[model samples]
Target: MTLREIMRYAGTLYSANVAASVVTFGVTVLISRDISRADLGIYGLFQAYFLFGAYASSFGLAPATVKWVASGAVDDGEFLTFMALRLAGISGLLYVAAGVAYLLSFKVLAVALFALPAYQVFSVGLSAARARLWRRREALVLVFASLVTSAWIFALLLAHHGYWAPILGQVLGAYSTAFVMIAYVMTRNLPRLRWPGAWRRAFWGTALPVFLGSAVFAIGELADRLVIRHVLGLADLGVYVMALTLFNVLNKPVHMLSRVLLSHFSQADHGVGHAGALEIVRINLVVLPLMGLAAAAVLPWIMPFLLNRDYAQAFPVFAVLTVVILVKAIELVQSSVAVAQNSATSNMRAQVVALAAYGMAVFFLTRAFGLIGVAWAVVLRWTVLTVVQRLDLKRRGVDILPSHLLVRASVAYLVALAFFPIAPWFMGIAYLALGAVFRLWRAPRAWRLAIGRAQN
Candidate 1:
């Protein structure tokens, strides 16, 4: 597909994601007012486990699937084998989480255990559809899943089911997505567990680094919640989780953009793709920080309107973590370049270093300063990740950005942030003016032209 086509498809996918995110966000907002903070915290831990399980069990199968399907290496038999591979790899994670859930008793969280792998199935289907550029089908699947989840949660909430409303609702929603996706894919072909000798090793070789890298990152994420829950109790964890939920709602645009960026990056020649991705990095260097400023300015004001007084403490954590979205957006673009270049070990290296930093800091920080320190530690981890990934990309000749530009952008963003609490409207205006001074106001046109020129 041309840059135009990929972007058009991205727009469609983004719309679907927005709709789904809105539904989930609406439920979250409603429940935030009604649900106990501790219950919210439990749901937060459930999410931590879900994310860890999904990534740990994936074995890089999701990306590998995208690579294979997008690269046209997956014929009928190949697709069947891939599907079988995904199922097999995902089962152990389900079993382990289920056992934990049972030990905790048949609670709202048991639903969490089931949903972990269920989400993987949902993810795999989307990965496949995304690789094939099946825009409409993928959109429908996402929207339907969100609708089902919202329906379940609302019903349960009205029936006075408490936390189970969101917990089981999320689980069933994941299953709904998986069911619809599997039903569609099954009509095309059946899954088969094949004993292909050489190709199997070849696939694993390509995927293992990605899997390990993702697993390490997932461990940090899940472990952070565990520690927080153990020390500060569920209330703290809930507040933190609530912050993330809100942040994610605001950050969905970048998330939506990332959904197709890997496909778009992979669709082109490696050098061209890397360049295209770096171009985006350049634009985001201006766009993201200011975006963060805008969010930082308003999120404090918005939190009260969204949540009641019970979760007022969440605001501090949320304020500290606003930088996460900015850093993550850059990492997303850089990550695509790493994966597309087929030097996946670079990702492992960067993530390993970041994980080590997070591991060292989270324990001490959580103990000392509560969730605020934990929040800062989370910030440190992603900042390290972006820096390490930048180094790796440059070593591989990806030309991430010039040092001068990086420094200037960093300083400018920091300056804007420093002025924000004093006079936010003025800060926003100053930030926009700086972006204009850098000629980043023309980025929309520049990005389009660059994409066209850089695409193969």
Candidate 2:
């Protein structure tokens, strides 16, 4: 796809993502305000555990589908069938194990295990659409799922269902959308469900490393919350989770871009060496840091209305967490590049090292500084991951970002965070205006080159 096409799709996907984030944010606000802090913390833990289980059961099939389909290396129908069957079998075993172990409440376990196969199916279906360059379909499916889930949650809450409301809503929405998407794909593609023997091997070859990487990464993602809950108790965990909930708004665009880039980069002849990678990095450098600044600036005003005064202390931690977004945006691009180059194992190794470091950092940091320390620990992990991934890309002869860009963006983010407590709106507007100027200065040149490439 041309850069113009990617931008168009990015806009659509980001809009859908924004809508989903808004709905999820509303749910977060409702839970934070109406529900007790301890219950909110339990909800947080439920989410964490469900994500880990879902990712584990997926076994990296979603990205594997994207990579194979985008690269024209596998039949979509065959791969989809394989994935569905595998996910179903694994999820059934997971349900049995959960039942035996009593890992979560019956409500939580039902949603986590039963809904997961459908969710993974939906995810793979969406990835398949993305791989086929069906951007609108991809966006629509995601929007549909998120909206349905949010509506269900709202309805359940109104009906006076307690914490189980959201979980049940999620399960209902996931299954409903999964069946719809599956039917759509069957009708649209008429994909034959034959096993492609060699391609099946090839898929596992790519997916296994990613599965290990993602599994370990999932653990790391949950580590902060788990450690906080264990070390500081549920109230502090609720506070930290609230901060994360707010920071997720900034993360929505980054997630959307990663999906677009993974598909685009996988198809690029030069992979990460293509000019598009550098353009992506440049765009993110301006957009992400400014987003962090804006969040820090506006969150103080918004928190009073959105959250209870009990969560008042979470705002500073939220501000600190925004910087993690900038670092994470960079890492997202790097990991996408690695995947594009079929060097997922290298990225996996980097993540393993980063996760270990993160685990240790979160343990000590939470002990020392409480909630803020947890935010700093996350920042430290992402920074280290960014460095490692950058070096990996450099070794692969793909230096998409200059060292100065990263250093400047990091410093700007810190300065914005520091200033937020003193002059929230001014710092926010000032940094956002600077980012706009930077975009205006750089975007035209980038687009010219992209257009020139496309024309040639």
Candidate 3:
């Protein structure tokens, strides 16, 4: 609401993310350089499985916790106790699944990826404890653990042989992240238990719909990998995975920014007096495009250095994905509004439409054009989702599209793209220059608004 509060929220997110991103980006760059394309692809397949398993394990409880916890309607200790129980149960289930997959076939390791879930559940517990304490710094510690562990494992991977590096690195990192959270909890003296009521409500209220939506979301996201693995083999999947990793980076800021928005906006008053929705829109406008242009300029330069020359072809893939990030940024901000309104059902509907459109587009396009078509399909999917989400928000009297914001975004991106191919360093300059120009163009209005809110 206030500039201080807004900044505190933003700072909490970006600071922790900056640490994690630096480590991730560094390791990714190193791994991309050191590992063969085929190895990378194999690792990617494993990662895909891990992400799926992790999300499934959470049962959507992560996002739901942010919502319910932010509302301050429940006892912190009680909620955390409940979260601990659910997480432990989920972790146990995941281990069982992993064991079965291992016994069935080596291939099932890709689907039954246990390490991510094992790490994620503990990470979830830490996050829940942080929510209870309202301690942002404490929350950040887990991220730091992830970063350090990832870097160490990445280095180890460079020394080691086989696909096991990625699996081990990720699984070990998950464990480290969980351990940090658990340690923090013990120090805080938060009550830990296998509480039944909290578990029931959390699953019913948060996890179930989320799991359904995640499955749909995962299908759309993982389709290319599935197709590539089955059709073209691990080598082709390697190329695709390289491109996908860049997209994931581009998507992270949007994802984190959305979390910050959901955490605060969901709890704040949303009446006419609040203008919470409008404020959210303004903040997003100021934020998303600036980040997008930065990506456009930075990725091309970095990709060559990170990946093997064979993967140079993925530059275009990166470009297409940058567009996807911009579009997704729009959708993410809008989705925050839906979350703020407690309209999970509406959010689910929107995801369904986007997923269907994405799947169809990818199927047709990929069939005709191969891997490049898959990239284009991603762009198309995000574009359509942005439009649909905007319409939905408009009906709710939330205006996310600002003309001036669009103008600024277009100008900044065009300028960055022009400089991108010519000189990466120059593109960085363009980002700074354009960022300054955009800030002046907006007259520090957002900043001023934040200040005013903070003072109030």
Name the best candidate (by lDDT).
2
- In the range 1-456, model 2's lDDT, one tens digit per residue, is 766677677889998878787777787687677667777677777777778877777788888888888999776667757876787787678768667545555655555666677778787878888988888888888888888888887887787645676667777888889888778766765667886557888788778888888887788777888898999999888887788878877777888878887898888887434667667676676667777777777777877886664788788998888887778767887888788777787677777788878877887888899999999988887787778778776887777767656666665566556677678767655655555544422766666644555421
Candidate 1 local lDDT, 1-456, one digit each (tens): 565565567678768877777778778888787788888888787788778877877888778777667776546465666566668667766767788878879554556667777787788778888888888988888789878988888777887746767777778778777777778777874646454444666567657888999998998888878888898898888888887887766676676667677777777776667555555666565656666677777867776876674666676676567667667757887777677667778888999999899989988998889888888898888888878888887888776555445445554565666675577656667766776775443666657654675442
Shift in Å, residue 36, candidate 2: 0.6
Off by over 4 Å in 2: 103-111, 186-189, 271-273, 428-444, 447-456
lDDT of each: 0.74, 0.76, 0.64
Q: In candidate 2, where is summed lDDT lowest over 10 consecutive residues?
A: 432-441
Off by over 4 Å in 3: 107-112, 129-135, 191-203, 272-274, 305-308, 390-443, 450-456
RMSD of 3: 4.0
TM-score of 3: 0.84
| Candidate 2 residue pairs that clash | none
| lDDT, model 1, position 296 | 70
lDDT of 3: 0.64
